[model samples]
Target: MAAPSAARSLLLCVMVTAFLHHLQLQIPPVATAAAASPNKTDGRDDGRGKTFSLTLYQHETINKTAYMVVDGVTGAGVSQTTTPFGTIYVFRDDLTVSADRASRVAGVAEGSSITTSLDGLQSLSLAKITLHGHRGHRGSVSVLGGTYNTKPSDYPVVGGTGDFAYALGYVRSSPLDLRGRTVTYKMELHLYWPPYAHYAPVPHKPV
Candidate 1:
């Protein structure tokens, strides 16, 4: 009787050990680690990317930075009164760090605005903003959208080059001064780069 009981006990212990070994084989090390730390394997980690922002001032003056290249049927040059529909204006305005024109030049805002509305209060604008050593970044961002004369307007950043490669975001333009001959606009830019297009600083080539 004692021998039979010892044999049964040994058999039970062997069965339990085999069952645990089977479980160990079923769960992989990678899966176990992922389950232990939920944050690392979740979908939220994939969406992470880089972002950048900037604020610059654009000064527009008649026959200077702003000009009417294509005149509508109403007149030949920029209209002092209400601008006629179909009129087009081109600008290569200086972007400054501050509202003062004497401030450090950050870049240039080159684009065109076409009068879309009969009231001349709104226009379709397309612009390319080039940055020069502003915040240690050098690149150009392209923007296009409708610009309202009275209120602030938002333009989508469609593409970019150089340091701003694969950039995506928007620009908010607000008019600071419009009463005088020189109109000052405050441009607030919000830029983003995808995870794949990581921002790698370009090496300076000696001129």
Candidate 2:
């Protein structure tokens, strides 16, 4: 008996996504200022301010020239490998975020993500995201990290640069389209930033 095409496709997607997740975990995490101090961002589960959501529509293109193919996780390749680190995949994205569906693009996100295979199904991933807004006065923010198994389905927002300095939170993404080589992702972000620059301290309410 043979499996259905849709089911097979979905299964393959899941397997590939899982493999990519595993690949992401292998990348060494860069130590951020926020990460260095455990006391500051104490609770990874707890963050400040209201939970704001951003609808991020992402488009990626994969090819061999985007990234230098390395021999292993840490090796810096002198020459390009035929495959995307043996997977024939490397993509750069100029994603846009919106407040509404098909509305004017609010912000521009620029970054590149790579997928590498260790051996067989074993794989790795590396992604870097930087965000900038046109209408806002506040500075931009960036998210840098590796993902594994795609489980937890969410990764920390880590820290940011500019007016949004010291920002920390988490992000989760869902696939909107899977067109074999190309994929579209709808990413939802939950960010925690420092309190208002000039705001009154809250007096405790009568209990």
Candidate 3:
């Protein structure tokens, strides 16, 4: 009887050890949530008044070419020139990037606050440019549209209600003559979103 009892105890210990090993292997998948949730914005899971940060970038890549007349040219003849192209800036915002939607039914909308970073300019910079969201598509293009220019400063803040809605930034890339040289440039773009949505409770309540 004693021998049989000992054998049973050893069997139970082996089973428990196997179970512990399995649990150890399973830890990584669970820990992944703590690393970083994708598309999550700052101040998420917390109340309002939480300010986040983003990057406002602009770059110009030459694409295609067209000809135009250069000013102050001699003789009665036209001159052809290659067009230069580049984007001044671009903005992208995702409202409700991070929210405790699983806790409530009502959602929140993120809005944009016009921002600029001018001191970052060196010299001989172009005049500040502005954009109108409403004019683009009757306010359909972006939730809030306004002017922006070259500068190292905080970008605009964009948030809106509903589960999903995008107030996209405009893309401006057109050929322009700079001192007789044809050039193209695109507008800068930045995106901002806040977590303010909630999820409906399970077990629907009959109305």
Candidate 4:
């Protein structure tokens, strides 16, 4: 009886070992750390962030897109080329794909500039650039900063809405044409969105 009991216990131990081995074989292997992480090289969720650039042409003309509704202490009117200190100029400029005014209209830049310098060479500008026509580009970016009349100026991108949500960057505005009653600017936007901000890459036209 003792020998039979010993043989039964040995058989049970062998069965348990075989069952564990079979279970181990049936289970799948654990994934490696590199394989489990999201791919970062393709400008996606790699924890770095995404960047985009755009070049737009802004056209402003007196009595059309630009207006001086408020007169300064010096009594400068809309017809004047220069504004005096305390003058408020409002504009709803046309943004085009190219420098030509007849080119495809991409959007609108609506904002106001208050003359801050006595010589009217500088002003505080605030604008909301609302984009349109282009697919995958559906939003507005807010720009605000000081602008110099004679030289290129950069304004900070303070906020955004719609597809440009959580946008951050700066706009480098260079005067393309500042003749007669019309003024044109080449607006180069260097934009960025954080990793947490959802965004899709939009096809951009050549600058």
Candidate 5:
């Protein structure tokens, strides 16, 4: 009788322990992460109408004369290709486009298109950009033709492929230095792209 009584008491204690454990599991003591975090939203648009700035360094090669029509005066298909080394900035973020001499052509300009399309325009260009690692359209940058040197040029950012699919904006190019046959230019590109705005191909338009 004594042994049975002891056994029953032990069983009661065990059952009580299990009941307490079950109660603790039903009401966990941990606080939710969301509730503990500060209440603040990310301060950026959802990629629509977003603007970016690129500070590009262009080295007009010694071969620019080869594409010159009248030795840098004017001619059809007179285009110059420059290799660039610089940084692209988005607010405070920065990325390097300069690379292991892969010899990326920063941009191309044709004097003939400028001369024929726009009347009597001196110091102009039919600017088409192509940068390595640039979000250009289908492996090419849609043409951006305009007078990009009128007291510091502001050329349109027509259309692009890759990340710049329906890209729109302008590029302001200012001369940084002139070295004999190699000129250096600093181009500030202000870019904007919108959703569903890309893929809408347009006819050739002069700006």
Candidate 6:
């Protein structure tokens, strides 16, 4: 009988110790995490009507003087000529376009959703995007083209014309109406060289 009583007491003590240990484990220990923040640009007024820029770096080995077009369909085709590196666009969150418009180039289509189309553009939302590439020769490479796939972040309450421009290319066109409604836009721009070439003339004797 005494032995049984002793075993019961020992078991009770063991259970109590385990319960206390569990309670200690429930408490979280102090932790320190060192992580970098994501890159971001200053959002304007109310996360709308803000202009931003993106830079791209490129390098390619081309033997001929051909133009590459960075295509933008609705938005301005920012990259005008073949540049090794430069600013691409000044995307405005207040800008947008209609649902249906004939594509500048065939085969290339716009993104269905506003968010998807603006994916690349939003990457520049934080700040200036720097594109990198190998340095070789001028006119050796060029930006070809791109298409806009998304709508702007915000639009005027009363439908009105919104104007924007591409920073890289001087191409400008506007009078776009964003009638108080949020709509997505797609930009498709292209790169190409002139068919003709110019050369210095040499004097020759006529016979």
How far in Å is the alpha carbon of 9 misplaced in model 4?
A: 17
Write candidate 4's Cα lDDT for 48-152 as tens digits: 245556789999999888888877775333333458788888999989999999999999999999988777777899999988845447688899988887678
Q: Can you write out model 3's per-residue Cα lDDT over 1-207, one digit (the tens) per residue?
A: 999999999999999999999999877674455444434544332222222222212222222122122222222222222111221322222211112213221111222221222321111122222222211211111233332222222222243222113322222212222223323222232323232122111222212
**What alpha-carbon RMSD in Å does predicted model 4 have with respect to the real structure?**
8.3
Regions of model 1 farther than 4 Å from truth = 1-49, 74-82, 196-207
The residue ranges of model 3 lying beyond 4 angstroms of the native Cα positions read 26-33, 36-155, 160-207
- Local error of candidate 5 at 64, Å? 4.9
Per-prediction TM-score, please? 0.68, 0.46, 0.27, 0.69, 0.45, 0.16
Q: Model 1, 82-135: lDDT tens per residue?
A: 466778889999999999988999999999988888777778999999998787
lDDT of 6 at 194: 14
Worst 10 residues of 2 by lDDT: 197-206
Total residue pair clashes for candidate 6:
31
Cα misplacement distance, residue 174 of candidate 3 (Å) = 13
Candidate 1 vs candidate 2: the lDDT winner is 1
Ranking by lDDT: 1, 4, 2, 5, 3, 6
Off by over 4 Å in 5: 1-49, 62-66, 70-121, 134-140, 143-145, 148-150, 195-207
Residue-wise lDDT of candidate 6 within 1-207, one digit each (tens)?
999999999999999999999998887663311121212222221212222221121111122212223333343232221122222332212111233332121121111112113223321111111111112111111122232222222111111111221222111112223332332233221111111001112212211
Number of the top TM-score candidate:
4
TM-score of 5: 0.45
Clashes of 5: 4
For each of the candidates, give the backbone clash count.
0, 7, 40, 0, 4, 31
Preferred candidate (TM-score higher): 2 or 3: 2
lDDT of 4 at 174: 85
